[model samples]
Every structure is written in structure tokens, then in C-alpha cells.
Target: MILFENVSKTYPGSHEALSNVSFHLHRGDMAFLTGHSGAGKSTLLKLIALIERTTRGQILIGGQNLAGVTKRKIPYFRRNIGIIFQDHRLLLDRTVFDNVALPLIIAGLDYREITRKVRAALDKVNLLNKEKQLPATLSTGEQQRVGIARAVVNKPPVLLADEPTGNLDPELSEEIMKMFEQFNQVGVTVLIASHDLELIKRMQHRTLVLGKGKLIAQFPEEDS
Candidate 1:
């Protein structure tokens, strides 16, 4: 489970990125976060990913309070969390297989195990054949799938996506969201921060809205 209790963040100029935000995401739950460009969506995801520390309040992930998690221990904290960035941060110089294998490699998994996991993740995204291809050789949508594969290669229990569909067309966005649904169906907690309201409305998942460093609303899809 993920919990935020009275969390807030402020920049050097006193520009608030998050203000007294508090919420709970249960294990295996799926939710979306939406708002305009300056909304605290990205900041919220950052806090969850441990990429940014909350200026105040507490965060609990998987029963561990983030306040007690030291900076040096951050890497260990990330072992069970997966993050997908808007940019698809693939290594242009590497093959898709290697890129996706990064996390497993960092964990020093056996080569055979890494290969098995990478293949499984790629298969989930239907990009198994593109293993030898460079990220630059693929289209934007395919590259994004590569990113997703990389994020899930470790089989993390929690997944965080920041504007994952920002670079895709509506159709592609639907496809990607469906992929996320597939992951959630298999029991991975998923939280996506995006601005594609019209596109996501059809998917019918819960949505958390943010504005000016504060959570304004939460839309829980009745269909789910």
C-alpha cells in the first residue's frame, strides 16, 4: 500500500508543487492522476518514486515509512517499484534487450534469469522480436513499449507512469492504457500521471486530480 499524510513541496521561490496532499493507494489498486501542465501530477509521482523528497508529511510504501528510509537506502527501496517516464529514457546505443535488462543486471541476476525475464516482459508488450533492435530504430509507440518492458522487467509490485501516453495518438494511448490494465489485472499496483483526460475517460479507471500543489478531486470509475 502507498500512503501520503499531509505532504507538501516548495521550490526556492516559494512556488508550491504540492500542498498538504494525503491519500492512500491499496495494494493492487489502479489509479490515474490528471490535471493541466503545472498541476502537481509529476511532483506527486516523484515523491512516490523517491526521486524527490516531500518537504513535509509522511509516505508509506509497502509498509515502510519513507521518513525512516535513508538516502543511501533509496536504491533498495526502488527494488520493488517500477517507474515509467514520459521520455521513454531508452539507451540509444543499446539493443532493446540490454536496455530492458538493466534492472536485473543491477541486481546481479544470473544471465539466464535476466534473459528469461526480459523476454517475458517484451512478450507482454509484444515486442519480443525487437530485442536486437536499437531504440532509435523503433517508432515512438514501440519505443514507449520498450520503456514499459524495462520498467516491469524486475516484476516490481508497484508501477508509476508519468505522462506515459503523452507522445501517442488516441488509439495508441488506448493500447498503452490497456497494457497497463493487463498489468493491473495480474496484480501490480499502477499509478499513472497524465493529461489525456478525454482518452482516459473511456478506460474508466479511478482518477486523482491535482492543481496548484493540491489534490482537487478524485474520480473513481463506476465501471471498475
Candidate 2:
């Protein structure tokens, strides 16, 4: 449900992050974005998330042009897209349940609904029992799972993860990828920007590869 047509992003100093990158990710598609460090993977995701504006070209999400989205509407626009970061950005002092519940709370949901959704999200990441625990008390992998739980707690239609498995061991990385796969199976559009080529190969999903500031290749190729 994401389409980028001849999109390019250039920073203030004339550094181009993306150069005419064009791709269409249909609804429910699961894909990976891969490239070397400074290859513009993060910039591409930022453009889609509207965290940064494109220097040229256009981006359409679910048929809505992001260029038309006003600054006042960004919060509402983001409600449909869930983002997970490599570093588990959980509140150090809050319990896992509270962290996962934060988004729902901000959305003004009722307490009972928030409780139910938080529990369900925690269960998905196998962290239901740790709901009362602080982030510092959890293992590295558990902390990452907590991040995932918080991202999906709102059940957004599109999920974007940046280097989600970067800090975890191979086993944990695989586990995290599996969780993304599970979400995709249930129809959540999944696009992950990661540098782990080995892991991306193992997943065998469509991948967009970048180099410098251009889309260099697309694995398995798309049909005409």
C-alpha cells in the first residue's frame, strides 16, 4: 500500500539519500530494505513515515499523497503505521504494560480496552508475564520484544521496523523475523530496513537493495 514514484531525498548539504527510487508495495506484502551503512535505507523509511520530506517526487500511502498531509495531520496519519526501532525505546521507569499501553492511552481509548489490547500484544511477544516488570529488568531480547509489542499494540495496517534484530543474537533475530512474518500473514503490510543480508536471504521475501543513493536491485524481480 506504499508507492514511491521517482522519489529522491537530498539533505541540506547536497547529500542525496535516495535518487529516483520507485517501488510499489501492495497491501499485505512483506519486504525487506537492505544496503550498506549510509546507503539511505533509514532515509527511505523516514520518507514513508513522513518523518522527513522528500526533496523531489511523490509518495502515496494507501492512495493518500503524503505531500498533501499537513503538519497538523501527521499524528493522525501515523496512527495507521507502526514503527519499531533497533534500540528498545521503552520508558525505563514504566512497566511493560504501561509502555505498550501508552499509544492507546494517547489515542484516548478506555481503560478496559487498553488493558485487553496490552495483554494481547504482550502475549504475542511472549511477554505477558513480564507486564509488571520495568524495562531494565528484562533481557535484551525480552526488551526488544517489548518494543515490538508496543509497536503492534495499536494494530496498525502498515509496520516499519529499522534494524529490529541488530542487537539480538541469531536465534533471537530469527524469532523477531518470525514475528514479522506472522503479522504479514494476517495482512499487515511489513517493510523492514535491515543490514543483515544473511538473515534477509533466509527470510526469502521481496527485497529492495540500495547503493549510495539509488535503488540498485530488487530480488526475484517484480512482474510486468
lDDT of the candidates, in the order given = 0.91, 0.94
**Deviation of model 1 at 52, angstroms:** 1.0
**lDDT: which candidate is best?**
2
Residue range 90-209, candidate 1, lDDT tens digits: 999999999999999999999999999999999999999999999999999999999999999999999999999999998899999999999999899999999988976888888888
Clashes counted in candidate 2 amount to 0
For model 2, residues 52-139, the per-residue Cα lDDT tens digits are 9999999999999999999999999998889999997999999999999998998999999999999999999999999999999999
What local lDDT score does residue 105 receive in model 1, on the 0 to 100 scale? 97
Model 1 score (lDDT): 0.91
Best by TM-score: 2
